[model samples]
Target: MMGFPQLSLVPLVGLQYLTHSSTLLSSPWPLASGLQQMGISQGDVVLLLLPNSIYYPIAFLGVLYLGAIVTSMNPLSSVAEIKKQIADTKACHAFTGPENADKLQALGIPAILVPENALSGSLKDIFSVFYKLIYSRCYLALRPVIKQRDTAAIMYSSGTTGVSKGVMITHRNFIATVAHFVRFEASQYEGSSLDNVYLAVLPLFHIYGLSLFVMGLLSLGSRVVVMKRFDVNEVIKAIDRYKVTHFPVVPPVLTALTKRANDSLAPHSLKSLKQVSCGAALLSMKTIEDFVQTFPHIDLIQGYGMTETTAVGTRGFNTEKLRKPSSIGLLAPNMQAKVVDWNTRSPLPPTSTGELWLHGPGIMKGYLNNAKATLSTIDEEGWLHTGDIVFFDEDGYLHLQDRLKDAIK
Candidate 1:
């Protein structure tokens, strides 16, 4: 609720084409309202399988307004994966584009077609523009106070290494994480006069990119360059063209960044770049040092969290505190963290190797449809048992050791 209320605060007025060509093609509110008009309400679930487009934001927010839950999904989900998630969530309706229409139908679920040509009208075009103006203004005036405990989004845990679980995160958890980002990082940025341009190469589907990079940056009014997919050359060119400052890199991209020479990675006159945040997985110390050496002007930071935690918990390299390479910085204010014995679930003293436990506003409500998994992950005391292995140093710096399950017995 910074500037545009529900919209990004980073000024996009100059980059109108970027948004118009994507999200503004059709009236997002009307389309979102159409779903409510069609009968989905709070607590109801809707499965969405649309391509990476402007409709994603529209659909997501619309679901939020109606108090309904959205399960943003990958179109490439195998029949088995799609069926499983849909059935597990007990989704009553689905809105999909032509690409996945047949797949949704195969599930015998009620589906709505979101066609590419749904917004092709000269009269409707004028009306669409007018609709955006009124809706945006109304969104500002009527910016509702989001309840911290209210479930905002139901995300499927990436089943990459195993079975996918649906994680239910409350609006408060996200806001709290954003509060940490603003207090820790964004406030420093806002003090500067230089324009902030963010290159959002991370998929919104991922927790790292979605809340931290997207919502975090946008809330501060930074202009975001959205790429449907992460192509090396394309991202490089955009940064050069836009003079993008922030690039949220994951471990794989961090590896690539360090592997390539500075000249090979150089974008068009990108002097605006000053920081890079690496998350999703651990960034090697070697990579961090190499990157800092290559781009001395850029501050490299690392963050750690999981989908269950709304990507909160810890991050590394606070300028005000002791910056350590292997450490994931200090816990954000208002959040309590403990190191607990893996087997006994009892709190361990600092410097002792144990599983990380987090209790914060950002802790997700629970895993949707998996009471057993939820109970296992979150104890009766309300602490979230992060499957991550870590140890806190005497100075309160959190150092990454290994994942709980990944650690050798």
Candidate 2:
């Protein structure tokens, strides 16, 4: 984390607020001890079917603390879908809520509920004694030989192109992606991190939100306003209530906001907002211009990446350099890329549209247990053929056009 702007830090905010950074950082250890007590072992896979909440991150880290891999799935996923993933990952335990607990129980999967509304008698009662001890000063130190290349998380692909394959993102991938944001990204996201409060409506299970908001924000020592789900009105209210400054959203939200009356939210509700990062789909120029025009002070940054790259490959990290319009800024540090002509399988020149291939530590270990698919995407030379048809301007901004798979048939 960088030396950030001054503030009495609010490290994490959820159904319960843990205002002190030290307490927030210390909370995970006792929880990790509790997890160990549950017979969770190293190299085992633990499923997290949780929403954005205080328990999510702590549980995520605790599993990793045991040298185990963490895989999170959408809580709203169909029961069959959830069952399929649990079998695929061979997850031994799960952290979920009551809404989805019956599905887990019906499947005979042992799941610990992460409750929100009531604390006294809800199913959370089973874990409340353990949960309360999470922030206890009593720290449990279990230092395993955790390597960066060890699989940190397995997030499923959105499956837009094919069946959802589990993407194996490692620990190093997280460090590399966030470091670029803090130190190098157009010098924009640094210094002011402490002053930033992120609206956590994006699903924490999605790599975009997990890496950028949960993991990245915590590493930066910033405040995160956790939301169980995305509600447009709730988002507006939270922004005003918490003085949220950094916004990470999908294209549809950006598009929806363009049609909202200027007065739908109070004039000054979003006055403290400084940046809005859009991804998960193509961001229309009209949407970007509309947001910029309406806010005047806020900068809209669009980025592109896949779950395999840990949700960051190219981003419009620089506030001033984004004037080029329809591009996803520059390649992250330690990353090499090329645009190769599909027909000849040869590299193409700048402005030549071809399949984008990227090589870096950010590349995942591969699709879990799917060696063939992994080999198909990542070549022997460590290049990940992104399958997205893209071109770079003379100034090196990436412009996405289409997916090579979609282009074929």
Candidate 3:
């Protein structure tokens, strides 16, 4: 799936901008050539600091196509946060909007301004850089050798405990995520994944969103409706307008949607929504109950994962014979887990509370440039000690109990 030319042969529609798969495949060549012209080669890092847009996926894929590492940051991040990440990653260049171009320039890093939307006749002058890059005739003559083990991205973990650290994810890790997590989930459904319409409200910088939107679903030829940010009304309208089938969101978004379902006079506003997946945080039983009651037709599920796991943990699935709203489903395929007593470091039996340890191909290489932290998080036995306390039930459903580490948001 490297470069993804073989997988994405269908059309992709984002925010009314319809781009052919061939254009998506070839658009990266000019960008990679441009980066090479700027003297950025394999192993160099490029920062992407922009909101969700069609360009986000192109830029992310382009960086990987060049064999350079990509490190994405929140577009709304503070100047201090941006500076720290840039310094930490040793980024050579950046792709961002005009609002943050000056900030990167002031730090002596070259920045490429990415437009918020596709350029039309009137907006042509306003988005010259983006317009020129995608249409440029330049082609990369020599492609670098990128091994599966080489780092493809450096996504920063949510600095819940302290300052955020970069998690190095390899190409092989992403392949596993697509296979075991994304495509596997799609396979459990009725139709082909390419027929499913996905709403991309989750930020592209997060591993959950990045894994599904930018890499996984794209590889399966799914249509992704990209939003600049989350807005409840816009989300409803988009789902109705585009017939969005699969929506991946966090608990707050789900809660907001549930509230909308309760207040909206038009019951069919979200008639097209087939499944809603919640992650990043736990959903209260009340929230789950309300959602299930309000939208009985839509499948509501919860998943558990972290940046260290490349977002490849358990995912909720409701079958005709079984439905456990509280559990985070079973472990993903090709993945292993163990619930260990935190104090004793001993594995616990079913229904016993303990910290969750995960082992899989999707596990990240390590925290970039932090060997000590990496050693503590991932043990010598290669199990990633996810600091969340959880347990599995008799039915093999994983349930979240509490967090062993302090985390913010």
Candidate 4:
């Protein structure tokens, strides 16, 4: 979809082995056919309640290919949370790990067990739904005509501010995200993007991870090394073993990496890493400095976005002439933003701290089934009101100050 020719090698590396892009892209067809056979149609909601695995991208694309909607949840979520989401979205089916299958089954939802890794041992049942779906020879015919505005996914907000709401993202939102978010960031650096290898430690369920690993980076044909979860030890080994150049992480992971870098006997394991992109949460100034000082050669960039915005907003960029480690850099291309005064609801000028509001194609369609919450977040003019209090400096760099929402006690 990103203009790379369908060929022998495309862009996924899993568990120390290379999986051809053609294989990854083509595997979804059978899955789409299977979903169609199971009465799944366009607009039907399917939940992906699993961790980062090679199969994740396949299942996600498969559901979309069939014109069905995808809603993902953290695999570690309690049954009550899972049941609530299922009810909210009316999810007809779910793809999850074998360990979590019973939870879905107990709720009267069919769960297709996906393996934790590329290895087949994890899926001991050769006749499992995942096995049958992926290996099926029947190809999908008469694919549903998907519109750009059609809802592609429903990602739940973190609920730090309040109760979690399903953020509805459209196909156009994802297309714009890949174009403005992933591709533009790749172009800023000097290298063939196809040569870039990313270490995927962030959970694919999160917008920060999903936008990059599952959708965006693949468009550029960048090789992604998938990890089921983040582990400093395994992350180091993967970077060395796979020659990973790009690492996308959250603040905690960055902090953990900085600490690991300080304590490791051989920091040479991370010599191949070229850049580390941090997001999901704000990074303390101290954390930013520690990472930059520890990995002097690696570019440490912080981004600002939310699930409501489909992870498109401002991104940190460092050049030879300009570098703002603490600032979240500039607004994304084609994205218009405003720093609005909370009390007056008026747009503030530069250097004034207020809530950040963003208007862009990447903004969510709305909170699914919650017109009241959607209207409150997005105004009549269409700017998605990000509750983060931030200010644009004189140089146009966005600096996050605080949040309007009460802190989670």
- All models: lDDT? 0.67, 0.74, 0.84, 0.84
Candidate 4 lowest-lDDT run of ten: 5-14
Q: State every prediction's TM-score relative to the real structure.
A: 0.82, 0.90, 0.93, 0.93
Better of 2 and 4 by TM-score: 4
Work out how many backbone clashes candidate 3 has: 0
1-409, model 4: which lDDT tens digit per residue? 2533121111233334455667687888899999999988999999999987777888999999899999999999999999999999999999998778889989999888887654456445833778789878888777799999999999999432477899999999989888899889888878788888888888899998999988888888878888777778878878887788889888889989889888873846788898888887788988988888988999888898888888899899988898888888889999999998888989898998888889998888989888989989898999888888899999899998777874212
lDDT of 4 at 319: 88
Task: State, as a TM-score between 0 and 1, how close model 4 is to the true structure.
Answer: 0.93
Candidate 4: residue 125 Cα off by (Å): 2.7
Regions of candidate 3 where Cα sits further than 4 Å from its true position: 1-15, 159-162, 406-409
lDDT of 4 at 117: 50
Question: What lDDT, from 0 to 1, does candidate 2 have?
Answer: 0.74
lDDT of 3 at 363: 92
Rank all candidate structures by their lDDT, best first, as comma-separated numbers.
Answer: 3, 4, 2, 1
Is 2 or 4 the stronger prediction by lDDT? 4
Estimate the lDDT of model 4. Answer: 0.84
lDDT per residue as tens, model 1, 200-272: 7676666666675445655555566665566666555666767787788888876666555464654534467
Candidate 4 positional error at 255, Å: 1.0
Pairs of residues clashing in candidate 3: none
